[model samples]
Target: MVRQELVARQLAEQITEHFFHGNGAAEARPLRVLDVGCGQATQVVRLARAGHLVTGLDPDPVTLGAAQGAIGAEPQQVQQRISLLTGEGGDCGRWFGPGTFDVVLCHGVLMYMPEAEPMLASLARVLAPGGMLSVVVRNGDALAMRPGCAGDWGGAIEAFGTDRYTNRLGLPTRADRLEPLTRTLSEIVVPLRRWYGVRVFTDQTPDHVGPPVDGRQLAQLLDAEERAGRTDPYRAVAALLHLVGTRPG
Candidate 1:
């Protein structure tokens, strides 16, 4: 809940800030959005509900089916706003023409790729001029923070020398440092516009655990997380990073 809610909030802010500044009416028209690797389509449905034309693509049919199921459960209006494709991010260009999307979301997907640059290049190629590229990646620079927080001194020590880690699900995954990814985005012609930290202090929460049921407590926790995510030094040490870029017009 924290991760998804924060992401949606930040995205709304950025979209309004960058695209709807003139008349204070940013929602004048629906934006063309693509969610690459939209697992279960949490963001896909959310964005569609916010009045955007959304296309969801996932390599796994099972995941696509899951996303379809979620979309089907929405009102007919929202259901009409989304389309699903079965494919991978690297194949984005192969499927869509250049400048096909106004907003492209590649969240929680890059960490699984062996090389982030090529995959980014592929996604960027489909972005229209002035299009937004939103990405979420594991914070390689702060890799030690998680293990250190858990009192695993040895694991923390091991994290410092590498950008690789085994995820909670026991799958080997990759992390990206801020500098390298920033450079890659520029190289791909989608220079980074903004970035925010995610799960800055709530990373230690076990996956099975749910957010506080108490409304006030949950709001306070989200407040702190949002503040820390946007603020300095704290964001630098966050568990995950959310980066937004724009292709030059």
Candidate 2:
């Protein structure tokens, strides 16, 4: 969906901005970033362009190859900033030494795993002290937001009764509340910041809201949405929740 794409882009921008701000770098250096389950490597490309040493790890060779192609055509300097690896999500421990990366991104991939604890632990382990972890997952509280918006109160209630939501593709998707996910970090002794809701207003709109609009308008709208996402009321309805946490130094 257009909204979903916008949310992903916004999240990426937020993460990049925070990283640069925290490091006080004109260009990020000694920066090691891992994108777990980085399908097609879009995030990988963005990080590389930002001058971070990026590694994209995924289980699918085909997807990894596609990502490689995507990154390969960039400026040579950007190309040199990235490395691609093929591996399962939980294999972080085997491939990365302890305290190796400044940032670890595990986005959209957490819902697929039956258990998130191991992956979280592995991510915490690889993160350099004072490093951050960015995670984006389905917003569990928003299960009712869509159905209620569509005037399907009964459907919304039924959906909220369950642990997860089903997509058009018939795949089961689980959502997580901000508190619970932050609590998980606490269990591991990681400190969590406030969560941002992604796609709050956009998700309620029809998939094809209108014909492709002006690029600048689109950008403005995404910026507004992202700003709203960080606040109260609006955040509750976001289709996805983004939480950031840091490993202790």
Best by lDDT: 1
lDDT of 1 at 93: 79
TM agreement with the true structure for every prediction: 0.97, 0.87
Against the reference, the lDDT scores of all candidates come to 0.92, 0.77
State candidate 2's TM-score.
Answer: 0.87
Off by over 4 Å in 2: 1-27, 205-211
Least accurate 10 contiguous residues by lDDT in model 1: 20-29
Supply candidate 1's per-residue lDDT for 182: 94
**Predicted candidate 1 versus true structure: per-residue lDDT over 1-249, tens digit per residue:** 799888888888888777776444445478899999999999999888888899999999998888889899999999999999999999987899999999999999999999799889999989999899999999999999999999999999999969999999999999998999999999999999999999998999988898999999999999999999999999999989999999988
Which candidate gets the maximum TM-score versus the true structure? 1
Clashing pairs for predicted structure model 2, backbone only: none
Q: What clash count goes with each model?
A: 0, 0
| lDDT (Cα) of model 2 | 0.77
Q: Which clashing pairs does model 1 show?
A: none
